[model samples]
Target: MGKIIISENVTLDGVVEDPTGDEGSVSWFTRIGDADRAAWAEVEHEEAVGAAALLMGRRTHAYFLHRGWASRTDEWADRLRALPKYVVSSSAVADAGWGEATVLAGDVVKEVAKLKEEVTGEIVVYGSGKLVPALLEHDLADELRLMIYPFVVGTGARLFPETSAVKPARLIGARPVGTALALLTYELVHP
Candidate 1:
């Protein structure tokens, strides 16, 4: 019932690995000021309010959700903590710590399809690189939202991978997030 929404921050080259140079992507993301962070926080709040559930890969669960959102006291953090989460993982994690979560350690793609049949509203997937490939390949993801940054990372992991099947996306909306970010919403035009 719920649509799987793939949302991420990407450079012009579609690199979503790590915007901050400490990890391996671009370095400009670190230079943004309070206004930029505030703008991004607003977007997070809006998305959290609209999202019905959280779906992500293991790395996203460990690095982003656990290390990031779980420690916050904000409304968006509250929403994320309260929402039901489905993590696509190869190994079972008994303590994901982020209340109401399930690890789909077996056949992630198939399990996610089943999850889609069970839930309603928007199931947003954050930075889940490994799981995203399967979702895109299987045509399970319904919507794709890219928070396109100002620059490009010439050599890094890209958002769009090599695929034999054509994945068409029709641009539904585009808006600026402060001076540094451009939010682009696209509906996955599947055949």
Candidate 2:
């Protein structure tokens, strides 16, 4: 079975929303220097290269499409454009149009469980705020790769919601990705 990995860019306080500050929120991601940003990009590219496919929510899929990330000429962008994508959405979408993608609109748990059985290697999820929480709740997510920024956004969307049931995760890797960013990888332990 393939591993479902939730990869996210989060702030120090665990906020995962408004990385670009386009929504009038503080953009902690862009606060870092150019070299630091480049370092983070390099790390992201490596992750992309290792991933067998990309998974995300409809909003995130649209956000990247609208921003023209698929249209870029860089190696990282090209890799993203080439990968197969799966978008979790409620509405019907004939085609993703970004690349080889399919819209998953049925029971998310069933669809993702089947996807894990069908594919091999890492199935990486990026910026799927709603989907991530649901996946975790359903015990569908296998791993989490978080790129933590230095700034703490006082208020915004969070990666982990308030949960009474403790989800046990084993730390697999941890490293600094520049002067201001840190990359932490955790493997979720299921009972």
Model 1 global lDDT (CA atoms, 0 to 1): 0.84
User: Top model by TM-score, which number?
Assistant: 2
Could you tell me the TM-score of candidate 2?
A: 0.95
Give the Cα lDDT of each candidate.
0.84, 0.89
| TM of each candidate vs. truth | 0.93, 0.95
Number of the predicted model whose lDDT against the real structure is largest: 2
Residue 140 miss distance in model 1 (angstroms):
0.6
